[model samples]
Structures are given as structure tokens and as C-alpha cells.
Target: MLMLTLLGWLGGYLITTQLIFPPPPPPGDLFEVPDIRGGGLASARERLTGAGLVLGEIDSLLHPSVPEALIIGQSPLPGQVLRPESQVRVTVSLGPQLRSVPDVSGLAEDRAQIVLESSGFLVSVDTARADLPRGRVLEVFPRPDAILPLPARIRMVVSTGPALVAMPLVLGLDREEALILLDSVGLIVSEITEVFRFGRDQGVVVEQEPASDIELERGAKVRLKVGMSGRATEQ
Candidate 1:
């Protein structure tokens, strides 16, 4: 009788255990994994959920061509059959890789542009007059060594040479007066042509090449046509 009572207690204990913890339902059946590559995270989640599968851990990686938060790869791949409610792993793209901004200051503008572009960065040129050499880069935006995403625009300050000096209007002025005016502005007389213009005073400038108000470099040459009392000039 004691053994029989022990057997009954054992049976009751087994039943209680079964009721409290039953084995998980055999994987709800198999379903094909949908292609989630190139899809955004939200869309990928929806698709996976609809398939009775769960979106698994996401791994982010930098891809040059893929956009951010888009799936670049998937575990088990697309079209694979797996038990329902199985977790699907995916690799998400963090967009293009970020690059360190190179030191381009003091480099020439064209050279700087080339270097930045080669390093996968876009470039913008801002010009200013500096004591630095013409076309040299004076400063850079985001500064050197700053990390930025690919295709990011990097603005650089470039020299537009020393402060601009507009050419003075020396037309109709006498040769002596024109010479003095050009000299005062760091310019020099390159050539002088004598022309005969009726009613014009001798040694008076009749025409000047490059006209006036045009930007010219220091010590640049200015050609002048001087009025003379003779018509013995080439046309």
C-alpha cells in the first residue's frame, strides 16, 4: 500500500510538471526567407514580420555605394527555407566610409582639389587675398584630420593673389603724364606707338591696350599709342 501511494504521488508530480512546462511547439512550419537586401530597415522589418520570422541582430558596415540603414547582406540568404519565427540576421549599411580630412593647406588649389577628390571628398574653393602665394590654399573647413563622410564638401580658402589693383585710365593723357601714372601704380611702359590724330596734342596718348579698370599684376606692361604731328605710322 505504501509503494502504491508513492507511485500515485510520482504520477501527480509528472502531470504537474507537464502542465507547467510543455515543450515548445515544433517550429511552426517552414517558410522561405524573403530577399531583404537593399531594402530599408523598416521595410525589412515588415517583410520579416510578415513571414512569421523575427528580425535578428543587425550588423552595420560601411559601403561605398549602398545607402545608410539599408540591408547589404542577410544570413541564410534569400529564398532559404527555415522554420517559422526563426531569427534572420542582416548586415546593414552605414553608408559610405568616413575619411580623415587631409592637410591641404599651403598646397596649390588644383593640387588640393585633386588630393581631396582622390580621397573621396568633394571640394569647394573660397578665395581671399593673403600674404601667401597666389592660388595657395590658406585654410580648410573641418580642419585637417577631421573625419567626414565620403562625398562631403570640404571648403578651402585660396589666395587670389595680392590685393587687386585696377588699371588706371591713361587714355588721352600725355606720354609723360601716363608714364608717371603707371609708375605710381607699379606698372611699366612696355611699348609706345606714335599715331597722327588731327587736333590732338603731340605726345598725348590716343589709345591704350587693355583699356582701364582691368585687374593687372604688379609690374605688368602697358602699351600706349601716342599722338604725333605726323601720319607716317603703320595702320
Candidate 2:
């Protein structure tokens, strides 16, 4: 009877010991951290999860050489033993830092574009006719000395040179002569209609469209009315 009792006690002791304290895990059972630097946050998290590990707190900072949201560094680097309940901490990049817009007014288009791009800005060009020479920057949006985020798009207004020209008089002249006169001043003949008048000779221009010396755009069209003799019979 005593032998049976002692056997029961030994079995109970073994069961209690196992319940109280677990055996240490084998070395190979631990997770080895993977190199995740330069990888995106989503991918890093996936990699950690795949290795039987958890992702820890993340830190962010501006980094010129690293892309945004990518892992720039990590705590407990790759190949380290990852404890079962431990997490991998990472530092992520937030891309280039912010900077102010420089004074690019009066600079040529190509030079301005290069300057802004080098300063980490995107560039857009708009053109307007101004007294400034063609291809010269007339204005910069957001203005100079304005604080802006990195890679901000800057729209520059460039000059397209002068646009206005004076209209020339071409009245009482032959049709071919009128065409030649208009062509010399960058103007085109839009229409040539005939009008009958007592004093004017046939095929001569009696009136001009935009009469003389009026400011207009170069290449504007001018209409003319030629004189037709009243004595002429209809065909």
C-alpha cells in the first residue's frame, strides 16, 4: 500500500513541476530579425510578421537621401535574435526637408527652372505679354521670401515680348497695292467688297477697315471697300 502511495505522490510532483515552470525553448525556435532598411513601412511590417515577430513603435524624420515612409534605420538590426514577445522598432524617412522659395524674378526661364528644381521645388511655366524681354520671368507665384514646403510647385510668369502694333492706312489705292502695304506691317486682307461712289475711280479702295494709326495686334486682318463705277452694267 505504501509503495502505491509513494508512486502517486511522485506522479503528482512531476505534474505540478511541469505546470509551474516550462522548459526553455530550443535555440532554432527563436525568430531572426531581417534587414528592412530602405523598405516601405507596409513591407517592413509584413516581413516582421512573417518572421514570427511584431512591429514596434515607429519614428519619423526628414531625410534627404531616403524616400518617404521607408525604413531608414531599425533597433535591434538584422540577424539579431527576436524574442517571442519582443517587437522591432524602426525609424522612417519623411523625405526632403522644407525650405523657402528663393527670389527667381527677372531670371531667365531655363535658369529659374534649374534653380528651383535644385532647391527641391517643382516648376510650372506661364507666359504673358509684358514690357520685359521675351523669356524673362515677369512674376513668381507665392512670391519671394515666402516659406513653403519642400517640393512646392512654383508657377513663373514669363514675358512673351510686345504684342501691339499700329494699323496703317491703305485707302484709295489699287487692290494689289493695298495688299502689299498691309503685308509689310504684318497685316492680312480679310475681305474686299465693292462700293459705288460718284468721285472714286473703279477698283480703287474708298475706305479702310480700322481707319489709320490704331493700335492692334500684329497680324490683324483689315477689310477694304473698293469703288465701282455706277455706269457699269450688270452681267
Candidate 3:
């Protein structure tokens, strides 16, 4: 009778333990998703596998701050309960979008600035003395057709026409000295007239067409009359 009672008690204990209080599921069957954003693609894949999850479809897009091939986004956000071997979709970065600098040379300054700004570039203008018309774009830094990341700063050189300067006094000076003085002031001597004069005035500049203190564009031509002991000659 005691043996029968012992056997019945053991049977009841087994049923309660097996049915009433079932054991927890195996650790491998569930997982809490891990955060893999900002990690490299290869490393993210390894991380997902280690967490009992698998990498799913990968999409890529141009991201300004995120580096190329790095994970920028993921589905099944971190700390979510997921079944083992569940797939996690990710979006990878292709880095900042590259842009080709457009040809803005010869365009007006305002137009060039608009074009650059429209193309996702920052614009800065610098005035320079050029042969082109005033306010025209002479050139651009990084040159045309150069490729760079978006939002890059571009420096444009715009024409203010030719530079102007006051003509220097060359009268009564030696011809060579007069030439040097004119050159120093950004003036070019285009014509020279040789005139017969007294011995004291020989080899000296007697007159200049534009006179002194006249404002003229840089590289503007000036006519000079020089004294000579020989017969007067035109050159």
C-alpha cells in the first residue's frame, strides 16, 4: 500500500511540473534586435548574425553626413523582440551626392551666382580687372566641369573692366626715363614723335598727349613727343 501511495505522489508531481509550470523557450528561439546604424556593412551583417538575426534587403542613398557603405537606417528598430533568424532590412549611405561645376564663365555675375546656387553650391564673388565687360564672370575656382560634393563653396572672379590710374608726368624727362615712368603707372606708349630741338632738349620728352594727372584705363596707349638733334621724324 505504501509503494502504491509513493508512486501516485510522484506521478502528480511530474504532471504539475510538466504541464502547470512549463519551462521557458530556448534562448536561441528569440532575440532583441541590436542597433547597427552607423556601422559598416560587413560589421553590421556580423552583428545581426551574432544576435540570432539575419540581414535582409539593403538599400542605398546619398547621405550628406554618413559615409559610404555605412548603415544609415534599419528596420525592426533596436530592442524590439523578434524571432530568431528574422530578417532586418537596412539602408546604406552612398555618401554626399557629387556635382559637376557648370560653365559660368562669360555669364553675368548675377546669373552665374543663380546657377551655382541652383546646383547646390555656395557662391562667393570676387572682382578682378579683366578685358571682359564689367560684371561678367571671368572664371571660377575648381574650374568648370570639375566634380565635387554638394554644397561646396565656389569662388567666382568677376570683371570690373580694366583698372584705371592717374597718368604720370613724363614731360621734360629723358625718353627712356619717361617710358619707365609710364610703365610704372600701367600706361603703354603706343606712338613716339621725334622733333628737332635745341641741344639741351635732345633725347628728352617734350610733351605727352594725355597730359599729367589724367585718369586712364590700365594698358591704355599714350602718345609722346621726344626732342632730337636730327631732322624731325614721325614714328
TM-score of each: 0.46, 0.43, 0.59
Q: Which ten residues in a row have the lowest lDDT in candidate 1?
A: 226-235
Q: Could you give the candidate ranking by TM-score, starting with the highest?
A: 3, 1, 2
The most accurate candidate by TM-score is 3
Candidate 3 lDDT tens digits, 16-107: 98899978876756798999999988999999999999999999999877889999999989989798899999999999999999999999
State the lDDT of candidate 1 residue by residue for 1-235, as single tens digits.
9999999999988887778776677665898999999899899999999998989998999987898888999998999998888999999998998899999889999999999999999888889987677999999998999998787889989997766568999987878899999999888788888876775667788899778999987767888898885655433
- The regions of model 3 sitting more than 4 angstroms off are 1-30, 166-235
RMSD of 1: 14.2
Global lDDT of each model?
0.87, 0.83, 0.90
What would the TM-score be for candidate 3 when compared with the true structure?
0.59
lDDT of 1 at 111: 91
For all predictions, the C-alpha RMSD in Å is 14.2, 12.1, 10.7
Comparison by lDDT, 1 against 2, better one: 1
User: Residue-pair clashes per candidate, as listed?
Assistant: 0, 0, 0
Displacement of residue 23 (Cα, Å) in model 3 is 17
